[model samples]
Target: MPTENALPQRLTPVLEARFGLDGGAMFGIIPQPLWSRTNPPDDNNRIDMACRCLLLEYPDRNVLIDTGIGTKWSDKERSIYKIDDQDPGMTDSLEARQLEPADIDDVILTHLHFDHVGGASRVDEQGDIVATFPDARHWVQDRNWSWAMNPSERDAGSYRKEDYSFFESNPDAPPLKLIDGISEILPGVEVLPLHGHTFGMQAVKITTDEHTFIYLADLIPTTSHLRAPYVMGYDLQPLETVEEKKEMLYHADRNDWILFFEHDPKQAFARLDFDDDTPRAVPVNPDEISAIG
Candidate 1:
């Protein structure tokens, strides 16, 4: 196997969906004035965020990282989160690259939160919920699945049973692979679990030749969340999130990991930098990237 920081043979960034959320809740303890400067909010104090997913084109399989907030919500529900219906979604995104949902062989869900796993399934003409990627195996942590089955009062609202009900209702549905601990779920793709945000929220570490790309799901949703203490109030274990941020940031800086953000509006892929002993996330210009390495 290649060593750390290996670059991938092929990778593409796909913007599946976008939403606007309350700025205060997104930044948690950070003041609006401070966070708003980098991420300007709308008239209602809402910040724009993208449900971006990574598409890996390998010889054996085409893998998708997260499925974004899907089209399963009522108009009222969409209005509440300010989900943009005009934007191209997961299917549209895949079509742009000359591929269909059926072409996806695997989907690695960071967790089962609506925004992250909503697109995993969708409603058909008969109004029955079905797996969006009909031929793909959806991978999620066993611990996280158990927690979502019986969620705590604190996070019950985030767990929408309707989104994943297809799995329970269909006995012969597409495969739902339950993973355990950190392992290479796919060739060169490693899943690392971290608590504090949710029960088993995971970050995907992709090893490419001479480069390591980390998909920061909710662990560090946006660039503004680079600071250790700026964790979201939505986190089940806020303090644990903070601790994980510190350790992850340090590891990124030391190893030159390519950090990918799932929710940042303008910035998506970046590298961790340090100035005067302070760690910071510096965005990478796509033009500068010749490959995943």
Candidate 2:
């Protein structure tokens, strides 16, 4: 269902998987009953989560943003995440769009977290590690480049040695690490970095003559987090997230920005609003997402 405005845009999903984790863990300190009303959980107490990655076909490049959790996990790990080897999964979505593994030109990682960057690599014929996109350059922020290579003990799980070893081995593969501030990676698109959840995590901002849309990455995981105080516990600096959201939402409200959500299962883009000028979201379905904005 497209919005009132027709934005001719194509969004391909690299993955479509669900997880069952504690509802409390999903929304941090938010009360269970209130959040549950919006997102209900299962018998195991974990709510169904959507791990979606987007592939954008710009005129010149096949730019993909974020790679959902890859299939490099063990049976034990699979059981832990409750990985469903069923329909609506990553491969299914890719095939539906008539895309193959080698079709991607560039993988734009929003951050180094496992869920975001896992699909960056895949195992090859020789049992040797290899980049998922052999011909595509992998993009990351300069600050996060070092941070991921040398992650702290507390965050080591997010950057597994096995996953990144492929990059270290492939000397010729392009590494599109950002060298300057607020750079443009695609036409009519800009990378705006704001640190709160992870250092150097950038939200892609795309503007057209008619409207503006910002891919509010993890900044606003779901519409449930639209309110300023709904920062996730996983964020390193919650107060910083508050400030960042305040600035983003203020601009979103004034400019009538259509925000593209990363983790929201049903809706991808939304036009933001607030009864009292606070940050809120109006769902924008795929049909409504125009190439213009």
Candidate 3:
């Protein structure tokens, strides 16, 4: 455990929500013998996944990275994804640290995927969709907003209409603030747009005086995906994903950056070690990193 003094007010991981996804779909073209070795599947051939989100506490504002799949799933959808409804979500995670949705000043969505943005809104008493963090200004990449609005046929199925309808339904008071290119949405917190997983998907990079943490959103959902060629089948541009992974891995390895994975079930974050010029993912002790004074 880290001493309170060493903890950074600027970076924290919250809402450790778990779900089950098809093992084959996760690894794409990778043989079961290889991917299954790292993430063993259950009897249903589903592998456990974590929809981990991070909380950024700045002097001026409190920001949430991505909202995990919330409580809006239908019974069938819940069972299909093997979503653990009982698992404490964003609300509980925040309350544990003496906070609430109203306390969050901003929400930065990497993309509008149901899993990543589902928790951003909820059904109200009148059965109307409302912002989950009513007081916060949500940020999203402009290009992604356009892409999600008019999604390609290849990825149209992955997106749920209800998941993002809130953005459209309220034009007068749009909850989202569209960002352009790579910009620091917050002090020391920058968004880098990457293509492949989804158009205009932005990865959050957080830097402090002593350490840096890069939230790898869906670009690299798990540590096992460190391989340059292990691109997700869900990615629109598989080749682009491979190339981006290679470049990102090289930069991360060189800088010794802590790669925070969004869908890794067991490992929250990892470090890379180079062997024969190949960068390999190595799980690091979350406890070891909790304190970085």
Candidate 4:
């Protein structure tokens, strides 16, 4: 959002797309009639979920945090979820921000859930597994990476074998760095691990000279789940999610941190403005947020 020469491109971050997908597990204990209004479901009963991906263009590298539900899908799976792939798929969304797939120098995986890591692999020229970020070092939490690599049958759908194998198959795969706690992936890019959404579910935090924003991965998927109790039913440990949110939300509100959501279709980024009773993440347009710092 900066003027042509105001600041370098990479240091000035700009978030991209905000469109919905299908997800019923998000509703959780909320009643169908109430939740349905916020997100109408397809004939298959899957709710319209969002695939909001972030872009951070630094002088040294162009980083993409998560790739939402990609183009590769079986006709059966497509029919079940009512996929609209041939239209504005993930690449098209990235292109809207004047970015091409080849420009991405780093792909950060919050966790290897199908929705989050769907675009990590592409059909290679020889019809084999290959890294989508051919020039970028792919990152994953060691704990979550292992869990995704050897997933239980219950969560098997979350881990696509071909996608995971793509990293393994490429022996020279650009350093698959897996670190713990807070670590810098890029000059101003750091990742923080927050449990509950998945084990070692990490959030991407980018700090500029004057402002900082944390891309709250699956920790707070949609704006609807901003409430501590409004957790995803698919979480392995829902109580842990509640506690993590309780701690983070308070600090997030206090410090005025921008909670850039991954799955909020209508909102690009939101800031938590806490009230006495319930906290609120008032959504801000990309243009408004870009003017900050």
Cα lDDT computed for each candidate against the true fold: 0.85, 0.71, 0.81, 0.71
Select the stronger candidate by lDDT from 1 and 3.
1
Candidate 2 off by > 4 Å? 1-9, 12-15, 172-176, 208-210, 290-293
Off by over 4 Å in 4: 1-24, 93-98, 291-293
Which candidate wins on lDDT? 1
TM-score of every prediction relative to native: 0.94, 0.87, 0.92, 0.87
Residues 164-226, candidate 1, lDDT per residue (tens digit)?
Answer: 767778775689998888978876899989988998888999886556889999999998888
Cα lDDT tens digits, model 2, 62-151, are 667787777677898878767664637666776776776677777777777777777677667897667777777777787776677887
Q: Which stretches of candidate 1 lie over 4 Å from their true place?
A: 1-8
Colliding pairs, model 4: 10-57, 10-58, 20-49, 21-49
**Looking at candidate 1, what is the lDDT of residue 138?**
90
Best candidate (score: TM-score): 1
Residue 236, candidate 3: Cα error in Å is 0.5
What range of 10 consecutive residues in model 4 has the weakest lDDT sum?
10-19
Model 4: how far residue 267 lies from native, Å? 1.1
